[model samples]
Target chain A: MNSVAQTFSTAALQRNPAWAQLLGLCPLLAVSSTLINAIGLALASTFVVIGSNVCISALRRIIPDAARLPCFVLIIATFTTMTTLVLEAFAYTLYIKIALFVQIIVTNCMILGRAEVFASKQNITATFFDALGTACGFTLALVSLGVVREILAYGTLLAGAHTLFGPTANNWTIQLMDQGLLPLAAYAPGAFLVAGLLFACVRTLRSFKKIPPPKSQSLIQD
Target chain B: MADLALLLIGALLVNNFVLAQFLGLCPFMGITKGYDTALATGIATTFVLSFSALCAHLLYHGILAPLGLEYLRIILFIVVIAGVVQLVKYYLQATSPVLHQLLGIYLPLITSNCAVLGVALLAINANLNTLETLIFSLGASGGFTGVMVLFGAIREVIDHDDVPAAFRGTPLALVTAGLMSLAFMGFQGLAG
Candidate 1:
């Protein structure tokens, strides 16, 4: 039980897939322009990560070491497809906006990295907690970036929640300003800048506390 | 001809896969420390990207769409891409040892590069024909290589500069990329 709790917190805060490890930046940067899109993608990715992690953990013993990567890709792709179809059927509007990014989640490296590093070796119970924690960390990153970008670009929070939550959320938008302070925050350039600054801020804060960096294994080999 | 030319130019500049569209960022950030390796990886990526895009287009149009198996695209495209990367690896190993040594390490990495899959899916989504898909893939990958080479050159310069501890490695690189992206945004009107 203690180990499970440790795994959860470690994945969520210490070794965050986004900020610290830099596992899945493609979707992180692309779909984070709006709060609705970010939430939509985050939910979809969370579903994929947990689904694939559990399945891979359950079947890890049977999967051949030589063919593990192909097997992992297949499982991730299946869950990604399921997420794509479900979103298309229910949230067609939001789905259209982020369809490409959603489909490419199979290649996000974060999911595949977890499968290769954690799920393939651990049992289903540990894998489940790890997946959950990683998903939460990814969600935190995406939502924070979404909130920051949405506020800077559109001057509103949850501006289009209706697309995800249906007609009731039409008024969920909270207008923070009459006009967006920095329209550039809505585009690709703004994504890199904001993400860079965010990383720098986190590093600065960590340095202030003089916390030694965690010895987390990097998911990507470069 | 005019439209294809416009598509090429648009993809190469206005909708660059790396700087502007935010695809293939893993490799964009990962293997960009040295100029020689970066350029080699870019060239290798360009080759695999165009090949996989062509194969994906044919597979989708010839097989999946006809059979109403379009929903299987995400799975099929990835599998096909992985296969293509393997084929390229072997063909390189057998044919030109020198070229293989230069690019072999990067070939496998291309299988997971989102930009390759992005081009395939984007072409299918835009309903481009075979020729257009080929051209678009070339343009997109060309843009990828161009930006990668440029970023690599810039990184070489950045290494000597006195960057702060908090922003030394990836953060600094990202800021440089943001500046490059800003510069690329100026090409927006050129395509329009």
Candidate 2:
């Protein structure tokens, strides 16, 4: 497997920053109550991660060893501020709802982790793919968690689509059920529960592939 | 006084930094393996949270606000928090080598703990006065420590119990935290 495929796999499943490494749980669980909010925050984070990766990888040669962490943080925080300001301008309402978590992305270890572990060591092209893959993984976790929480809590999908989309998209909210859904699914505790289930499911699935039982057992017996 | 009391209660119970708002969860989950470790992490976090709250309040009002650098608050607040963590680490190293050894890597890791920065930003956002911010930080950290110790104890107990196949480690910890959060939900209507 080439570096691109390796990085992509790492981001998507094998070492997904959200699930496998559990780097950015705060933002992962905080703003994922609704699909729109999830998309909004995910996009912002993707932008910051990609931007920071590019910057850090490009400047890797120049950044001193002692000052590496601070430099990486400065670059990440700059992109975070840029994303925050842009979102505040265009997606004002969504920005307000997620303002706290959005700004907190500066502290999201995923981006910094990518910077230190992958980007700073790799070339520009390789780093780009790594960043993209990692961002997609993060987005995957966010949207899935958001979908589950939104469906369970509000009995709807795209309930706040208008926040991200324009006025024309205001009617995009899809009602799934009338009532009887657990409201706890939309809150922080629910995020933990859903996240735990998701992690277990993934782990179980991975475990199945790890053992080709008949072939391995026969070989061992022989 | 009543408002301050309400603020304390709100931070502690209603809007808990971890179970409810999801702030500082990295440490809440990562360092909570044992009771003593969790207590150390929680107290270290509380110190950073409270100290950063005071510093952020002062900086936001005195320097950043005066310079109209509100947009720079995130970057500046993070820098401040990181600086405070370093200072605290150094202070511990100088005065309490045993404590420093106990904390180990967690001391520096506090800079990345969202609770410290979250508390600072939350206090600034709430526009709390200095005293109010201190009280709020106290409550928030107290709540954080309380939950950490609680979760630690539960996890230690669960380690001895017979658990299912897939949900042995982190998944179990999270599910336990979920149930604890549900129990904490009972405190919802107590505030306000």
Number of the top DockQ candidate:
1
lDDT of 2 by residue, A1-222 (tens): 486898787666766778777779999888988889999999999999999999999999999977888889889989999999999999999999999999899988888878877888988888888899999989988998898888888899998788898798989989989952989888777888988898788678778877221111110010
| Model 1 lDDT per residue over A45-97, tens place | 99999999999999999999988999999999999999999999999999999
Write one digit per residue (lDDT tens) for candidate 2, span B1-192.
Answer: 899999899899888889988998888877788899899888888888899889989999999999999999989998998888888888999999998888756777788888888898889888899999999999999999999998888878897778777888878888888888888888898776
In model 1, the Cα lDDT at residue B178 comes to 93
Q: In model 1, how large is the Cα lDDT of residue B36?
A: 93
TM-score of chain A of each: 0.95, 0.90
DockQ of each: 0.71, 0.50
- What tier of docking accuracy does candidate 2 attain? medium
- Misplaced by over 4 Å in model 1 are A209-211, A214-222
Model 2 error, position A151 (Å): 1.5
